[model samples]
Target: MSSYVEGALVEGERIVHAGRISAWALWHLIGLGIILLPAFGIGLVFLIIAYVRYQSTELAVTTKRVIVKHGFIRRQTVEINLSKVESIQVDQGVLGRMLNFGTLIVAGTGTSHAPLAGIADPMAFRKAFIEAQDEGQEGI
Candidate 1:
């Protein structure tokens, strides 16, 4: 769990699902790194970038809301309450379908729409969100 998500949690909130960045999303970087590995180790830079990006991003669905944190130094965070989310859309290409990774677009009540790319198992994330939303509604 990332510090941002841990600290952002309110009373009685618990994470129901935690999403991750799939290595398949960094295929280009990994491929370039491998191809350039013999050229004075320049490939290491690409690999490092991929690693940093994968490590820095955090995605989770909680009992109350959906939380996403991106970036290592400069940060970007998105939070949408379960009651406020209007829809969760998943986009997956052929390769993404094969690898089980895709993008998630979360549309909330009002004017908020968050697009989260390079997410692993986007369908699972959407399913989790829906389940959580249903549970929240039941408690109301």
Candidate 2:
């Protein structure tokens, strides 16, 4: 869990599902690094960038809200209450489908959609959100 997500949680909130950027998403950088490693140390920079990107992003469905954060210094965060979430849309390409990683678009009532790219197991994230939403409604 990222510090932002942990800090954003309120009383009684618990994470139901945590999402991550798939290693597959970093293939290009990894490949570039490997290909350039023999030429110079520049390849190390690509690998480091990929590692930083993987570590800096976080996504989760919680009892109260869905949260997503990206970046370490210049941060971007999104939160949508369970009751206000209109939809969770997943977009998968051929490779993504085979690898079980995709993009997630979270739509909240009266709010612009938040698109999270390169998320692993996006369907599971959507399922967790749906279950949480249902449970929250039952408690109301």
Candidate 3:
């Protein structure tokens, strides 16, 4: 792990949180292993680089917002509050459709910076995020 989130907090009895990219990016690694690794060492190096990048990237979700943290030196992290979310969408590809992995895009009510992407189990994530927000609101 990055050791950045050596410890963190999660709330509620049914804390449904967004799934991470580290969960579903194995396909990319597998492709590297099967097709590129031994045949082309340079390609293998790049594949390993990509795997490192993917592993570094994470999707953290809480009741208040969705957080996307990634990048090595830069460590770009984006958090969007539930109140700003106008809509949540899921994008599933062929393998994703079969495996139930997809990207979740959250549209903001006003001036969205960038939509979230490369998430696994996007529908579940969306439901969990909304439910957590609702639960948080209800508890207040």
Candidate whose lDDT is highest: 1
> Model 1 over residues 28-133: C-alpha lDDT tens digits?
9999999998999999999898899899999999999999999999999999999999999999999999999999999999888999999999999999999999
True-structure RMSD, every candidate:
1.3, 1.4, 3.6
The whole-model lDDT of each prediction reads 0.93, 0.90, 0.67
TM-score of each: 0.95, 0.94, 0.75
* Most TM-score-accurate candidate: 1
Better of 1 and 3 by TM-score: 1
Off by over 4 Å in 3: 1-18, 22-33
Each model's backbone clash number:
0, 0, 0
Sliding window of 10 residues with minimal summed lDDT for model 2: 1-10
- The digit string of per-residue lDDT tens for model 3 on 4-65 reads 33234345332246466634546666566657657757557757766777777766667666
Model 3 has how many clashing residue pairs? 0
